[model samples]
Target: MTEITPRIPPLPRAEWTDDAREVFAYWGEPNAWEEGSKTNILMTMGNHPDLGKVYNIWGKHLLMSNTLSTRHLEILILRVAWLVKSAYEWHNHVGYGLNAGLTLEEIGAIRDFPAGDDWNEQDEAVLRSVDELKNDGVISDATWAILGQYFDMRQKMDLVFSIGHYVMTSWAISSFGVGIEGGADQIGFDLRTASGKIPGKTYKPGEVEDWTDTRGY
Candidate 1:
C-alpha cells in the first residue's frame, strides 16, 4: 500500500472562520470536524465555500429525504462506490451500509455481486443498475424494468441521483487525493488511482480487511 497523502489537504480546524463554522454547522459540526480533526471531504470542499454550500444543499436532500430506505440507498451507494473504485467513498459507506442492515459478506460481495447468493432480487436489480450506469452511462431498459418492479417513481429517481452524487464525489476525492479519516484504512487503491497517482493514504490488504470488517457501525 502506498503512503497516505493529500494533494489538496483539508483546511485545518484552527483556521475555520465564523462563516465557515456556520456553514459546517448547517451540515452538523461532526460532518466537517470530528473530535478536532477535519473530515477530508468537507474540508477540501470548504476551500470553495460557495460551491461547498450548494453541494451541501443537495447532499442534505439526498441524505435526509425519505424517498428511499437506508438499506436500499446504501446498497445503491456501495455498488457505485465499488464500481468506480473510490476508496474514500467505499471506506466511509462500509459503516453506513452495515448500520442499514447489509452484512459483511454482502458488502464484500458487492465487488462481484451476482457471483454470490447473498443478494436478493431487489439487491441484484440495484447492483445491476449500478453496473449499467458505470459502464454505459445509463441503465439498460432490462435493468430499469427490474428496478421499476420494486421501486416507486421517487425511489427510482432517488436511485439515479444517488448514484450520480457518489460518482461525482468519487471523482473529486480521487482527483484531490483526499485523505482517509484518522484510524481508517484505504481500500481499492489500485483501481482508484488508475488515472494517475495523486498520493493518498493506502493500507495493506490485510490491514484493510481488518478495518473493513470492524467499523463498529
Candidate 2:
C-alpha cells in the first residue's frame, strides 16, 4: 500500500550519552542486530529518548515474559492495530504473529472477529475481551468467563494490562504518526469506511458505548 511517510528523527544510537549507554547496558544489549528488533530497539531506546530509562526493556519483558505468550500478545496487538487502521503496526506484527503460530486466516480475521466464523473458543475469547476493552475500556462477564477458564489469575491480570498497553502503543502510532522504519508490508485495513457487512464500524477512542465490571488486575 502507498503510505505518506511521517517525518520522525533518525535513530541516534551511535552517539549515545553516558547515561543512555548505561541504560542500554542494563538491558543487556551491547550490540545491535540488523533484522527483527532493530527498529523497536532504535525507536524505544534511541528515538523515544525522553521516555522512562528502562521503558524499552521493561515494556518488552512485560509482554514477552509476564502476561502471556508472544502468540497471545501478538493477537491483541494485531487486533488493536487493525482497529486503529495502523498499517505500520499490522505489517510489522503479522510476521511475528505468524511465527508465533497464528495463521494467515486468523490474522486477517481479527479486524471484525465478532462476525467471522474463523476463531476457536480460546482465540475468540481473547479477541472479544480485547475488543471490549479497547472499545469500552472494560470486558463483559460473558467474555471474562471464557478467558478465566483458560488463564490463571496472574495470566488474566497481565492479559488485561497487556491489551491496554498495546492499545496505548497503537494509539500512539496512529495519532503521533510514528512511522514504521523497516520493511513494511501492507495489510490494508480500511477502518474509516465500513463495508456494512462485517462486525461493525471503526473503533474510535473515547467513544466506547458500554462498560462491564472486570476482575482484579
Candidate 3:
C-alpha cells in the first residue's frame, strides 16, 4: 500500500502542554512526552489533550481491565483491525496477538475468518459476531446464543464494547492518517508478503519496562 501522510500530525513533543503530557503519561510511562509513546496513536491524540485524557481511561479498561481474556481480546481486536483495514491497529495488535498466544496461522486466519479450520466453537462464534455486527449492526440471535455458552454477562458486554471501541479507533486512525511509527516496512499487513513473518516489535505480556508505574492500579 502507498504511504499516506498524516492529516493530523502527532503533537511535537516540544509543543505538548501540561495536559498533553498528562494524557500521554496515562499509558504508564517514563513520561510519554519526554520519551514518546510506543506508537504514534497517542501522540496524534495529543493534538487534543482533553479528549486524549478521557479516551485513555476507556481504552485502558478495555486493554488492561476488561473481562475478556487476553486471547479473546486480541482475536476480536485483530478481526476489527482487518474489517476496518486499519493497518496501524493491525500492525500493533499482531504483536499483541502473538503475545496473547495466537499462532501466526490463527492471526492470518483473522483476515478471512471461518474460511480457515483453525477456530474452534467459541472462537468461531466470537469471530462471527464481529462480522455480524459490522454487517448488520447487531449480533444475531444464533451468534449471541453461542457467545452465551462461554462468556458471562460482563464478558458479553465487554465483547460488544470492545468491537465498538476498535471500530471507532480505526475510524480515527484512518481519518487522521496515522502511519506506522517507524515506516511502511513496519506495517504488519503486506499484500506482497502476506504469508511472511509479521513485522514490528513484539513485547512479552506486561513488558512495559519503561512504564513500570501502573499509577496505583
Candidate 4:
C-alpha cells in the first residue's frame, strides 16, 4: 500500500473531470513505447504547462534519444524510485526496467542500492554512480572509472542528467500529491527508505529533495 501522507494532498475527485478522464484514458494506453501505467499518467499529467516543459526537456535530454541505453536509463529511474520510496514511479518503472534488460533480482536489489546483493562489478558501478550523483552533485572517481568501461561521454552525460531529471519528477509527484496511477502495483512495490532525501527541492522547503542547485544534478 502507498503511504499517502503526502506533502500535498490530491485534488478532490470532484475536481477530476471528463477532460481529466480523457487524459487518463489516453495515458492508460501502452502506445508510448514501453511505458507502463504510472509513467504514462505522470507523462500525461506533466502535460499541464510548466511541469510539461520540464518533463519534455528532461525526457529529450535523457530518454527520447540515445543517452544511456534504454536499459541503463530504466535502471537509473528504478533506483531513484526505490531510494525515494516513490511507489508510483517504482511500479511503473520496474516493468520497463525488466524489459530494458534488468533482471528480477536486480530490480529487487534496487530497493537497497548502496548495499544491494548479486550485483556484478558493472551493476555496482551504475548503482554507485547514481548514488554519487544524487549525493555529491557530481560523479565519483570510483564510479566514473567503472562507467567508462561500458559507456561513452554522451552516455555518461545522459545518465547523470537522467538521474537529476527523475529526481525532480519523483520529488514533484511526491510533494504535489499526485496519486499513484491505478494498477500501478500490478508490477508491485517494495517499501524502501522513504526517509532517504533526494538532493533537490521538493515543493516544500526543508523537504525531501532540495532543488536549489543551479544545475539539475
lDDT of each: 0.69, 0.61, 0.79, 0.59
| Model 3 segments more than 4 A misplaced | 183-185, 190-201, 204-217
Clashing pairs in 2: none
Give the local distance difference test score of model 4: 0.59
Rank list by TM-score:
3, 1, 2, 4
What does the lDDT read for residue 25 in candidate 4? 35
- Candidate 4: tens digits of C-alpha lDDT, residues 58-95: 55546547566676677788888877767667755665
- Best-to-worst ranking by lDDT: 3, 1, 2, 4
Query: What local lDDT does model 3 show for residue 98?
Result: 74
After superposing candidate 2, which stretches have Cα over 4 Å from the reference?
Answer: 3-8, 11-15, 21-30, 33-41, 44-52, 182-217
Residue 1, candidate 2: Cα error in Å is 3.0
Worst 10 residues of 2 by lDDT: 208-217
Shift in Å, residue 41, candidate 2: 7.1
Model 1: which residue pairs collide? 4-200, 4-201
lDDT of 2 at 121: 87
Q: Which of the two, 2 or 4, has more TM-score?
A: 2
The number of residue pairs in model 3 that clash at the backbone is 0
lDDT of 3 by residue, 31-74 (tens): 46676665578888889988999999999899888899989999
Expressed as tens digits, the lDDT of each residue in 72-159 for candidate 1 is: 8887888888777787777667666766777766776876676755677788888888888888999999989988989999999989
Candidate whose TM-score is highest: 3
Clashes of 1: 2
